[model samples]
Target: MLPLFHNLLLQLDSASGILRITLNRPSKLNALNAATIEEIRQAMQYALDAQAVRGILLTGSGDKAFVAGADIAELAELNEIVGRRMAEKGQEVFCLIEESSKPVIAAVNGFALGGGCELAMACHLRVASENARFGQPEANLGLIPGYGGTQRLAQLIGKGKALELLMTTDQVKADEALRLGLVNHVVPAAELLPFCEQLLGKILSKAPLAIGMIIDCVNAAYDQERHGYQTEANLFGRCCGSADFREGTQAFLEKRPAAFTGE
Candidate 1:
């Protein structure tokens, strides 16, 4: 059963081990306010704790926007201290999503600007609708992306392309985003969720423990302090000692499907 969270900023539903979380502030273009940010953090924690939730699909409520940006009204009220706190809060929440044990896929339906774009980047994978748009428009506001966008954006695309987008505040169409390696796939708006589900379903069929390990290892690649190869080797050694590994190898030799218990 899916836990019933107060639906102030999000609509949460679950089925077949897949949790679908829709950012629910269409009237506000799904902008991230303080309350909404807290709700998202709580929702991600819920997904992480729930054994039934093997994967997550994140999207927005309306066709107009996946998320337009952070709430400008809220931003207008921020003093230097408050502004720094707000950025830290957002970064913490997004980091939780990025470091999740289960795979989280962002299905961008429309505009994903500023914090919206950062949110999508935090996900394990991203799928965009044909009409979706992506950008970091904080430069126009005399601000910079504070939710790890400066880092993740450069990592996904190259440093030069990321710098151009960051400096110019250029909005890229879904096709261009795909070309830049921002999105994994671009489909019609109507098919975005279904496409993500189909892809997640395939991943969910694999050994869950290995899936988690893969997430950990891949994330380590982007950590400047950690050597990616060393991380991978450590994880590989750990996997070799797991029951799932034994079962997988045995099943391979037996020419049969392996039943992974996630052990």
Candidate 2:
């Protein structure tokens, strides 16, 4: 069974092995608050542990936003210590999403600003709608992005443009975001979830073990303590030892489709 949340909706398509997590606070534009963040952590944990879930798709309930930002009222109540704790909590949860073994994609339907943008960046891939807008506008509120945005934004785009956006508090339209590599694809708002499913379907068809290893190796590239090349080699060896790898090679030789059981 799927985990229930007060601020989120979880639906899993067993045939596709895709778990869809919809941010349901449409009245507040699905703003991220402490409660919502905790719920996301719990939901993500469930998705990761569920054997039937091959991929995850994240989006907001309405067309207006994936998530606008953090709740302003919540922010207003933070002191320096509490603010630091909040930032740490958000970073920890977002890191869980980033390091997930299963693929997690963001279907950005509309505004993805501040914490929202950070959340999107944590996903393995992002597919944005034509009306989607991305920004790290925390500067406008006398703050900076606290949830890995400063790092991921620069890594996705570049340091120069990321700095420009972060410092200027400028919004990037979907087309521009696509051009800058912030999103993998941009489609009509109505096609957002469909496009994401199509993309995930393609990815999920591959060997699950290899897919997870690729995720691990790619993430290792950004980790200062890890050697990317060594990590890749180790993961490659692991894949070669997996049952799926043997099935894949044998299937190719036999001119038949390989059935990977994720073993």
Candidate 3:
């Protein structure tokens, strides 16, 4: 089912230089059904057009689940050919999340399993609520994460932990997730929103072009070879010479909070 506010997988609002995208369907524990997937794709399109939006915060509608996983029922009936197509589509959608110019942060509030883990991993960063738990339970169902889970999880948490999670199909507690570097921050359930907002406050104030460049360079580093460090160096130099650089430096010298225009 579509969200009440829009034909989106979730609730989206643009305010304070941030876009808060809530994974709706609380009644279903916010599972990633087909409609939810389409809605997420639509939300990404909306983010592309809306100038006021800067950062994206992805979270579940309630405290019970971020997303249990993809709609397994949908996957059960697929044969070889259709399953391949489904995997391809899922990859495209997740790549769109990773490659978006704006910064994307996943606020994992509850159960982030399988595709849920992939979704969070696709984002630039993740923060979780105290109640959040994470896993890749695909092995239990005689499957694997179809949405870049194996690749991204290894990249974020190192190969050992990724393999462990995949092999054991066990869920880790929120603190364990933090220690493993799967999530940037973990806070009390009550403080989840405030913590996410605080993190975005810092990111939203940074130079927009620089942030975009950062994403480009990081993705390049992975998309190909270690040669991307050269590109990173070049972009760093460019940022140092940009207008935001000047404004930030001058503000520092003036001893007041920098009034960054994101120029």
What overall lDDT goes with each candidate model? Answer: 0.91, 0.96, 0.83
**Model 3: per-residue Cα lDDT over 1-263, one tens digit each:** 22244423443444566777888778777777666776788787677667777778888887889988877788788888988887787788889989888898898999999889889999998999989999999999998888899999999889998999999999999999999999999899899888888888788777787888889899988886556889899989988988888888888899877766656
Cand. 1 Cα-lDDT: 0.91
Q: Report the Cα lDDT for residue 191, model 3.
A: 91
Winner on lDDT (2 vs 3): 2
What range of 10 consecutive residues in model 1 has the weakest lDDT sum? 5-14
Instruction: Flag the better candidate by TM-score, 2 or 3.
Output: 2
Residue-level lDDT of model 1, residues 189-214, one tens digit each, is 99998999999989988999899999
Candidate 3, clashing residue pairs? Answer: 9-39
Please name the candidate that would achieve the greatest TM-score relative to the true structure: 2
The C-alpha stretches of model 1 lying farther than 4 A from their native spots are 6-15
User: What number of backbone clashes does candidate 3 have, counting pairs of residues 3 or more apart or in separate chains?
Assistant: 1
Q: Per TM-score, what order, best first?
A: 2, 1, 3
Question: Which parts of model 3 have CA positions greater than 4 angstroms off?
Answer: 1-15
**True-vs-predicted CA distance for residue 91, candidate 2, Å:** 0.6
